[model samples]
Target: MIKFLVLCLIFLFLPFQAATRKQILIGEINHELKNLSALKIVVFKPTISEETEYASMVIQAFRNYFVKKLAFDLKDRENISIEVILITDKEGKGQIIEQKEDQGQGTVFFGKSKQEIKSSFFNKEGIQIYPTRSSSLKENLELPSLLEAQSDSVLFLLDFDNTIVLRDDQYRGQGEHLKPLEYKIKELLGISYPKILPEETSINIGDKAPNILLEGRKLSDYQGMILVLTFYPAAYSGIFDTSLITKRISEHHLSMMSCAMHITSFDGLSSKIGGLGVGYFAVSESTPEILANWKEVLETYHIQYINNPDYSLSKSFGSYNSNGYNKRVCVIIDKKGYDILPISIMINDYKLGKKKEIQEIVEKLMINI
Candidate 1:
């Protein structure tokens, strides 16, 4: 009996990778996420202070990235509404414009607050704080009263409403035109800023993570590992910059565990790429010559590439990289194999190159994670 008690205690204390998710569902004892496929999000139409094509692009880009790529079930409903109210000093109060979309069957979205698992994920609205041209308002540069958010516990974000409004409104005056507007994401979301939006898990600390692999190495092999997985599209013009990526990785002797996606355009401008395995890229249509340039890049940079399992897109494993957004950003995944997957995304500009920053972030993440 004493021996039996000791055995039971040992079993109880062991960190079972599959145990945390066990109680979530009967059949999904091994599944890390609990019915996350049914998340219903309402993307409120965005309001911009000064109307421009960029604002429209940002809004639509966010919406499509959420609904289509991230696989959220976004639909219009009467239960909640997030009306983007842009109080600009330009010329008008704000305009309400509606766009339509189809709803997909996505899973439940939830988050924990204080302690209890509460549904923090809700329909989103935005309030952009910008110093408009101010045909009537004050001329001296300052945060106008028109900039304060009118909130009823509504989730808000910094220039989440306007990415460039910061540049045009305040930064240009300050002479910081080319920086990403770093808003108080915490103040806006009332929480830590997510590299990826709608981080929908209750416990991430020690929960067993779902497997994310590249080439042939299974993530399970690194059960206790935390890696910085960067996704790059071979077709991006930036990928050709050998000094930026190849030289940096070689100098740092970083792990070469990466994957490349082949894109084939149905139309001359639109294309389809991978969503499967451990990757996502934002790309547009390109010719066979550009696709073949991966070899040239490898040879020139002396960068080694990993080969992944040949899988079909119909296998429900990959996604679409629309509008060349993949070329705009690099995905840095924190694959804590036996826990939640935390990501640190870095936007890449072919001109400015992210080598130094990427290397620093990777080293920091490697140490901390």
Candidate 2:
């Protein structure tokens, strides 16, 4: 729950000195290993071009560095050379086997395919892998590349074909693959980082929502109100987040007919939307007190009578068909059954400027309605 922004400390560079900052940013890659343990990495060289050039780059960076430089950093220890393979469709599908256990490490691939750059830092050497051909992905493989990890084993997977990264713990990223190789490693390893775990990525509109939102709730009961869901992990302190953006929308009197108000789809139709409780190492937002607080935010925004939505992303809405979530996304579902992803923004995709784009979508919706 600690804000992951703390990782910025590592990137802050020298303050007030533009030249110093640039020097750090553009300077040569630091080859000195910073006491970080050498990792066992799998370099996924996909025979097919299913992954984007960037996704391929991420995989290669890991391979290039560990194979050449990482071992040198820990010369006293056995140099942990990376193993590589050009994963096939059948290989990606094996996450399909799905027997999940706990212990984990993450995956990294560093190198170049026709799609990726050869290398950047900590090393440029490549590890060659002999890959076995994969059989076709099966129709019943419900989950996308969902794989079980060996204790501390991190599976770095290239998608089934050439899509983006699938939503698997082992599938580190998607379309807007993390830049360079180093940062990708940071994010995947954040969970086990020495200082703090990284924040959960924002959930956006249009992407299939987590089932936790609709579990045990009945969507049939309330088929009348449109739902606006705001998602942040239980770890986020977004108490003021909904109120700020919603002030503009509230001015439009969105609650003219509903009996009550809600946000985060929180008050939409279920109490479970209150966010994970203390049991998950987070404070409970489901208590009546918290409900009152959420209601206050809704009221402040002039929203009313909208019970939390009871529809499961998969069951009620007929399956949460998420090609995959890009960045933090937010969606609007009209009660009459029009699903408008006017706010399909991926905050992580910086080039897309998704946050501003989402605001524009919201404004446009207000104008149209």
Candidate 3:
């Protein structure tokens, strides 16, 4: 059976032959990665095959962009080791193929599986050698690219606990002044603050909320079905403070009523007082330490917002444009923890309407899913 032996040898050696003039990305192989302290990496020159130069450029760009992030993630997990075998121009010519996606452009190339390594490199698409965890890795891995940082506008991010403190505490110089400061609610109305928070940010409506504490009380424990997270200057007996407090509270009640016209206020603002009632989780005043903490978190998340004690998040996200915080606005976070949906942001109305109709659109997006 000399013929049989020849066929067997060909099959065994075929992979090496097929691998020539192409890139090889060895990922998720069961072999010990920890043993690999460091390994050499290779890159294959790209050429225009049956595909467009633009499409090839994008793919090549992404591959280079993501490698660093991928390596870091893998190292952090401490489970796998990856080594780039080589990158070379394609040796043989093949039929061209192109894949497109819904919003933006997406591309796929057809050739030897070994030529290109992708997130979906090894399913039914590639040889499944050892049962691997590539799919799981794909989910957790975020490829680093300049795509996210390129957005032109400045993004002001804030965290719940640290950036703004809702409780009363003695502060050092200049810290007290920072509190009770009013935000230019008017500036927010007409100005574009991204006008949208992406689902990727993970803050939403109705999501199982973490128990937020205020004044030594867990707001999460409130039995009331509706929770309102309102911000405002603390209640003080001064004539100016008293009038502002009363007027703000009255506006909150009125807005709740309007929301009821479309839906019942019961399941609507479920009587929960913690995340609900006036001044629940609202951070009215804060200590320097507390403010810094919130600032750090905001910077980490890239949330865009200007700090103003006079303007609650409600007023800023709601009607009050550039001028200051006034009128109470509510963000109905869904059970899944995303902004429920943005409603109309109207400047024409005196009470200040939703300027971007973000609430309605966000609602539709949540509902359809």
Candidate 4:
């Protein structure tokens, strides 16, 4: 896998850059989006209270939140707009702004001023509140009135209430709210950006398979029998059956047997490698430790493993938790202790083809070996 820092291609602002400058950074927003979505759609307090510090973190969180959600909807969204606002009140309880989604275009929102926010907050009489377009406030304020008073030129409203929280607030506000613009931008760009894939950290056809300690055992234990070493994420018992596993077996010769190794622990038990209704070997190390050992083996072959660990091995692996598991993978270890070939597979969700898949994998392994 290619590993290079994303060079921020900033077009130097000449004497006069474009009338408006647009800078974009792409990333995966899955983590941020999940975090935000899990929380109740309401106002959250900032850790920092100083005007600038509070504003900055709030803006970033908002950007991270919205951009992540937006990108999730449109995976191709690489850029988003982030605007900042500074509002003040006797009490600094932030107002919750509502969000609305565009038809695959992106998202937009409006920010409120100090007076506007205070009026809205009191009108609703709730500290944790989300403002809405039609919310009736003591000042007879409306969405347009709030938008007009915002300091920022443009803002992206996530419309969380409309999109997710489908309920009205008790009084002046709504339950779902819009995050700030900058936060939304980062999240959107992050979510839209594709994650880096994992690399194959195992030996291949022509390379020597490195020896290692496997649960107080050595990697050389299975040197003679055609070693079918499979690595799967622990929680994927459903999809890791015949088809996804066996499809890769078709490439090998007959006489080779396969074994499945789940890398994740079950119910906090000590890590054990199990296959064929038996415990092959169990390593107690955390996932990171196991991956480090795998990396050494791959690098010895002058090959780079895809670091994705999110999808197929593809001779590349990484710490990415794609599908909540390491990349679904399998490897053929030759009698002489060489990794003859590696195959990456993806298990479709809830597609109950496990029985057929397992059967096909075994047949393919028997035939190809």
Considering lDDT, which of the candidate structures 2 and 3 is the better prediction for this target?
A: 2
Better of 1 and 2 by TM-score: 1
Tens-place lDDT per residue, model 1, 1-369, is: 999999998887776533321221211211222233322221112223213212332332223232222211123222222222233333324443433222222311212222121111122233223233343213222223333322111111213222212112321101011111212222233332213222122222233434554434564554444433322332222122233344545565443212221111111011121112223222222223322333332232222233221211101122212211122234345554335455454333222234456546555555654
- TM-score (C-alpha, index-matched) for candidate 4: 0.23
Question: TM-scores of the models, in the given order?
Answer: 0.25, 0.24, 0.19, 0.23
Decreasing TM-score order of the candidates: 1, 2, 4, 3
| Weakest ten-residue segment in model 4 by summed lDDT | 170-179
Q: Residue 306 CA error for candidate 4 (Å)?
A: 19
**What is the RMSD, in Å, between candidate 3 and the native fold over all Cα?**
25.0
Candidate 2 C-alpha lDDT tens digits along 1-369: 245666566457446353322211100111231222333233333322222222332333333233433312233225232233333322332221112121112212212231121222112235433333222221212223313221111234222221122222233322212112223333333311112222344444456433333324433322433344333211111222333335634575442211111233323222322121100001121222223333332332222222222112322222112321112223444333433222233232221123345445444443444
The C-alpha RMSD in Å for every predicted model, in order, reads: 21.0, 23.2, 25.0, 20.0
User: What is candidate 2's local distance difference test score?
Assistant: 0.28
Q: Per-residue lDDT for 237-316 in model 4, tens only?
A: 11112333245345432222221212221101112212332222211111232233232211112211222222333233
lDDT of 4: 0.27
Model 3's TM-score against the true structure: 0.19
